[model samples]
Target: MSFTSARPEDLLIDAARRGDVPYLQQLLADGTVDVNVQNGKGFTALIVAAYDDQVEATKALLAAGADPNVQDVSGNSALMGVSFKGYPEVARLLIQHGADLNQQNGNGGTALMFATLFGRHNIVPILLEAGADTTIRDVRGLSARDLAVQQGNEEALKLLPQE
Candidate 1:
């Protein structure tokens, strides 16, 4: 059987993924789309926008009341996605919208861990300043500082607090 077409709410996610700010705005204005709707993977529009580096879209979603702390199936939040992708502006927006800095993913990885793992030096300090707990260990037993050391990210290591 042929699957049905996309729903209007799904369009919000699509628009956010494509960075189509105008379309996303229109969808929000219609008031039919739930800003916090999750896709098959459990990702909200804000997470998709942040993952795609759509700064404007990310901002619009936050302004429309998207939950910055919403996680996907893997427990990865919008902040983690932006942090991993090195989207500092999007990361900032997520944080400002009340994202839990210490929220851990399925692997127990926080935004700080993602930022450090990907060598996102610019984002590292931002997370640190936001009070991201460096002591939190991932499922692999690696803290953000540990990951920085493992990745040979000297700058990140320098920024991390010594154990």
Candidate 2:
């Protein structure tokens, strides 16, 4: 069935969340789903795909001009979502497409911080490679290294390049 604009845009978002590539492609090709539409949770199709670790689906959205850097209502970008979820492949794709790693969320937590705090060791390198500043502090003035220490994640702590 053809997707309708009244479908809340989140249906396509949900499809992405499920990694339903074919359905998502169908929706994208239908010419009705807003590529940049945000759901009630402030998640866009790209964000959902990244969080789902749907690398192919995320690439498809990015190729179709989805804004990888589009922040949710809380200022969390797709990169942050993926990083927090520990999806290195998805995070890499977002970064390769120009996702800003240093962008902070409503809580002033950068993607690097989220990755470190969540023990996403792999994502730490991806964010750093994307030009994420290790020195950037969160609202509490805690850098990624500090958060890693607090979380007792030695692996994540090792990702921080010494200043």
Tens-place lDDT digits, model 1, residues 48-81: 9999999999888898899999999999999998
Q: List clashing residue pairs in candidate 2.
A: none
Candidate 1 global CA lDDT score: 0.91
How good is model 2 by TM-score? Answer: 0.90
Per-residue CA lDDT of candidate 2, range 85-120, in tens? 899888888888889878889888999999899988
**Model 2: worst 10 consecutive residues (lDDT sum):** 2-11
In candidate 1, what residue range of length 10 has the lowest lDDT sum? 1-10
lDDT of 1 at 47: 88
TM-score of each: 0.94, 0.90
